[model samples]
Target: MSGEERGKRAARNEDLFRQVNERLHDLAVISGSSEPHGKFVCECEQTSCSLLVELSAGEYGAVRANDTRFLVFPEPWHTSPEVEAVVERHDRYWVVEKRGTAGAEAEDLAERGSNLL
Candidate 1:
């Protein structure tokens, strides 16, 4: 696949994972859970990845402040260097910012709330 196509695909995968995490967060809030941190799945490009990262609501909110950014496991393998860059490194997870085509696609997905079904 072309680079742009690959970037788009990666963006879609990451967005889907983000949606799942969002739903889990919402559910936790509705259930009145007082847990300080939640286990969110790694929002990476790889569909086969099932790794989970723990983050508090505030930390996840920081990542969500930018549409192009995502929370991923703090390992090199969870990041796609071609379409994203590691912006922040934490103990259990890393923040990645999508660039180029991937950035545009991620922003679009966030704005439209599309491709979640």
Candidate 2:
């Protein structure tokens, strides 16, 4: 491709990144809500690629998988290489961001226990 075309592509990618951030904030509002009537975390981006996502704003949060809660997730998310990859996947078309507490934290508070992780 020509240099000019590449530059435009990069600019477009940057805009998508901003959109992802905005979508994350919107999803946070829904995910952080007290009720679970409808889904709040919808995939924000849809691509011709296999992984299609919807950016939603309301639903139950994922605090654990299987029987585990309180996962030791890398902090800041931005500095985590794997996480950054998820966010930059599809050549910047798919960006993943997280907000709010994990499931284990909620469960712990309910039981009046400390979050082990």
Candidate 3:
């Protein structure tokens, strides 16, 4: 695939991860309480990875505050160069934000009605 295609794919993968987290958050809300911390699958571009990162409700909220920001395993960006930067790093996970066209696509995904988390 071309570089553009790879970028698009990376952005879409991030959106998919965001959707999963949104659903998890909704479930937590309905259950009346969130655990002190919960495990969420790493939302990186690595298809072979099944790693789960632990995050507190507040931590997840911070990541959700930005449409382009995604929670990923540290160094996933090394393999997925489409990611533009590492905006934040926590003990368990890293926050990556897309750039250029990929960033725009992620923002668009956030605006969708289904993305209301």
Candidate 4:
């Protein structure tokens, strides 16, 4: 795949992971506890990556403020230059933004809750 294709794929994968976390958040809210922090799957480009990252509800909300920003483990193995840019690094995770066409697509999916490609 070309760099552009890889970037789009990465964005789609991360969005899917984010949806799963959002569902969990909704469930927590319904249950009344609504835990402030929880472990969520790393919203990275690598589909095989099963690593989980911890985030507070506020931190997650901050990431959701921009559809391109994703939470990824701050490890060397998680790097993907063609797909995303590491915008911020925290103790447990790094904030990555999808680039190029991928970013546009991610923003679209975030708004529509559906896939375009």
Query: Top model by lDDT, which number?
Result: 1
Better of 1 and 3 by lDDT: 1
Top candidate on TM-score is 1
- Cα lDDT, all candidates: 0.92, 0.31, 0.76, 0.81
2 against 3, candidate with superior lDDT: 3
Ranking by TM-score: 1, 4, 3, 2
lDDT of 4 by residue, 15-49 (tens): 89889878766666677764557777888777899
Candidate 2, residue 17: lDDT: 36
Give the local distance difference test score of model 4. 0.81
In model 3, which runs have C-alpha deviations exceeding 4 angstroms? 76-79, 113-117
lDDT of 1 at 106: 95
Worst 10 residues of 2 by lDDT: 64-73
lDDT tens digits by residue: candidate 2, 4-114? 444333333323433343455556575675432322222222122123233223211332121112111122332222211232333212333322222232333434532
Task: lDDT for model 2, please.
Answer: 0.31
Q: What clash count goes with each model?
A: 0, 15, 0, 0
- Candidate 1 lDDT at 111 equals 96
| Candidate 2 wrongly placed segments (more than 4 Å) | 33-47, 50-117
TM-score of each: 0.96, 0.26, 0.84, 0.87
